[model samples]
Target: MAEAAVTQARVRLADREGFLAWIFLTPTVVYVVALVAIPFGLAIAFAFSDVTAGDPSYDWVGLRNFERVFDDPVFWRSLWNTLIFTGISMFFIVVFGKVLANILVADFRGKWVVRFLVLLSWTTPVALSSVSWLWLLHSIYSPVDWVFRELGFIETNTYWLGRPNLAMASVIAVHVWRLVPLAAVIMMVGLLSIPTDLNEAAKIDGAGYWRRMFEITIPLTFPLIAVSALFGAIFTFTDMAVVYILTRGGPTNSTQVLASWSFLRGIGGGDIGQGAVIALFLFPLLLAAAVLILRAVRRVETI
Candidate 1:
């Protein structure tokens, strides 16, 4: 009787969709709580306290840290740089990603090898890749400078990461380079998921390639493009590795961003409260950006 009852319950549990969903979802929920939620709560707590690397005591400081952050000129400058970094990187990432995705989805010989090569940038560890770029852009014996000279683009060392404008551009370029492959892969999935019948019908109606793309492909893949953009924005907003590794916010903090600035303050400067304040600001900005993206996507869908 007991065994029969246990088997019946097991069968009932297995038959329920809700139970199955919770079963598969439990691990993800627990993972988010443990990693993301906990860290976020800690950051909020620290932002309101006087926590520091040296002090380590959590004394309530309220809005004092916020005031200090607002007063810092570097904070504002870094914020501007971060906006430019994320904006320009995202623009190129989307445009290049779409072009690459179209190429990727096309039928051709050596397509597999092309796909593999394209994914290498995304797969490579960021620090290792950034270090290689640093070597290329280093003032002494720069291969980029030599190549430019060979091509008659410059007469001397271009100092890619030395000039303020060039440094910002280099950071954005590297960021776009790293992210475009991932975006391409994402849009490729979207493109591949699209029903082939739609394209065939359009082709039968004498729609050219560009017309089919603008009408059918772009509309269907709009959601995925937004998804990729969100991913790129999150990565770009939170990322300081490229900036730290390449320029170290050098040439007068031209490449400095909120993420790097937060690290400089919290860890490097040992002001945990102010650092948390700086880092926490990214949350709302990200949230707003995502909301706007979703709204734009929805508006497009409606139209």
Candidate 2:
């Protein structure tokens, strides 16, 4: 009888454990289905359809929208801009972030204060920061202009955002500034996790600081750098905030990227189908980057 009772108890305990596991997973399943799966399906449908914001009806166009996107100069230009923006911003973010992470990782005086200020740039909202940059880069009554004038850099008030070349540079500069802190924080975390013994061993073997960094620190922290870079790439690629707030894809649409172009088409130009196409172009590239990064990170972890 006692043996039978123990068997029954074990069965009940197993049942309860199974129930708890299902309960924990239920919310995640529902969330993915509702938010991601459904929206992604809708966006895909919109990409293939002739759904305009001004028109109340959508007809199945069957790849015609995509063809139109290919032919559009605006779409191509936005794609070019996005590539340039992502490339330039990623370069600065990685270089500066790695340097800053190295600095903060070392034991120093007032390190916390420096870190707090460095992080302050990223802590502020993008909209607010973009607006602030707008004012700073303005032609008249701009602080940057005033400072440059005082320094004898320029005699005239320069409208930085009004010029096409200067506007793109300004946008890229703001993006790099906004994104560097977060990248640095990510790098710092990875740096902190590295075993100190390895660094010490390298030093004892007559490896200089740069040598140690290149051979030991960088290779080990490579996964983190890739992850940080992936994040920066995605943010810079899809970012419409700085462009919208600062340039508005203006001065001949020189600063337009995929996101802003999508917004302009869907919201401003009333071409929803084309807008959806523009927005979804980044999706495949982002997914590819994410998959590659994750695989690299896993490889590092195994090593």
Candidate 3:
């Protein structure tokens, strides 16, 4: 009888454990289905349809929307701009962020204050930051403009966002400012996680600072850097707020990116299908990048 009772208790406990596991996972499953899966499926469907605002009608267009997207000069231009913006911003973030992380990892006076101020750029709201940048870059009252004129760098006040080249430069600069903090934080974490024994061994082997970094530190910490870069790429690729607030794809649409272009098509122009197609394009590229990075990380882990 006691044996039977113990068996029954074990069964009951197993059942309860199973129930709890499901209960815990239920919210996440529901969230993914509702938010990610459903929206993604709908976007795919919309991309193949001819959907417009207030039309009360949509027809299955097969690959027509995609073909149109390929032929559209504006779409291609936006794609180019997105690549340039993401590439330039990511370069700065990785190069400078790694340096900053190395510096901050060492003990120094007032280092905490400097780190906090550096991170403030990212913690600040994007819209508010963009607005502030706009004011600072304004032609007439801009401190940058005033300083440049005072230093005789330019003979006159310049509208930085009013020209194609300068507009692109300004947008990329702002993106770097906003994104670098997060990258630095990620790098700092990676730097901290590295076992000190490796560094000590390298030092004992007469490896100099640069040699140790290149031969040991960088290779081990590379996975984290790759992950950070992938995330930054996604963020920059899908970002519309900064561009909208700063350039509005203006100065003749030279600074337009995929997200802003999609917004213009869907919301501003009322062409839902094309906009959906544009938005969908970013997903595959980012997904591919993320998958590749994760695979590399996994390989590193296995080694």
Candidate 4:
């Protein structure tokens, strides 16, 4: 009798929509808790404690770490660089991604190859791609320089990663290259989901491509654009791998950002508290960006 009752209860629970929703979400919830929640909580605790990589002990230190991070000139430089890096990357990413998405949606021959090539940068492992870029941007033996020289654009090889401005530009360029495919794919989905009837009707009404795009297409896809921007901001704010691999925040720390700076201080420099403090600063900026972007998405037309 108990076994029969248990079976009936299980069937009822499985049939319940809310219960099924949680069941489907169980893996994601567990993953987030184990990976994100725990690490974030520990970081918060470590921020207020005098923890170091050498000594794993957590000793309460109040706001000393925050004070130190505030006074560090490198921290200010990293903060500035982070803004510029994320801003410039996001601008070009969205613009180029939109253009690429338009091309992707157009009827063409051998589009499968184009799509595969476009996705290569995003799908490739970051470390591997960064290393490849490092070779391409090498002080000597750069094919990019060869192309430029052959075109009469320059007479000699340019130091892509050895100067402050050029290093920052190179890092931003690589980061944008890696991310644009993802943004393009996302915008492509939004583009595809746009109803064809709308475009057709607009064309019948004598609306040109630009007019229809501004009036109907862009309005509908604006939300997804914001979503892509949100993802870009998050990736930009948290990623340190490219910076670490390509330039190592070199050229006099010109390409340093909060994410790489935190990693450098917390792990490499062996100051856990300071590193955690630096990391915590990222949360507010991210939160603000997310809130603003999400708000914009919510207010726009749904795709």
Quick one: best lDDT, which candidate?
1
Which TM-score value belongs to model 4? Answer: 0.95
Q: What TM-score does structure 3 among the candidates reach? A: 0.90
Q: Report the C-alpha lDDT of model 2 over 1-303, residue by residue, as the tens digit.
A: 999999998888778977879889999999999998897788898998888876848799999989988999988999999888888999999999999999998898999999999999999999999999998998787999999999999999889999999999999999999999999999999899999999899889999989998998898889999989999988987789999999999789898899999999977998888888888998987787688878988888898
Model 3 ranges off by over 4 Å: 1-23
User: What lDDT tens digits, residue by residue, belong to model 4 across residues 11-88?
Assistant: 998899998899899999999999989999999999999999889987899989999999999999999998999899
* Local distance difference test values of all predictions, in order: 0.94, 0.91, 0.90, 0.93
- Count of steric clashes across candidates, in order: 0, 0, 0, 0
Cα error of candidate 3 at position 61, Å: 2.8
Model 1 residue pairs with clashes: none
Ranking by TM-score: 1, 4, 3, 2
TM-score of each predicted structure versus truth = 0.96, 0.89, 0.90, 0.95
Q: 175 in model 4: Cα distance from truth in Å?
A: 0.6
Per-residue lDDT of 104-135 in model 1, one digit per residue for the tens? 99999999999999999999999999999999
Best by TM-score: 1
Compared with the true structure, the alpha-carbon lDDT of candidate 3 equals 0.90
Ten residues in a row with the worst lDDT in model 3?
Answer: 49-58
Off by over 4 Å in 1: 300-303
Better of 1 and 3 by TM-score: 1
lDDT of each residue in 1-303, candidate 3, tens digit only? 999999998888778977879989999999999998998898899898988997738799999989988999999999999889988988998888898889889998999999999999999999999999999999688899999889999988789999899999999999988988888899899999999999999899999999999988888899888878887888898899889998999889999999999999988998889899999988977887689879988888898
Comparing 2 and 3 by lDDT, which wins? Answer: 2
RMSD to native, candidate 3: 3.0
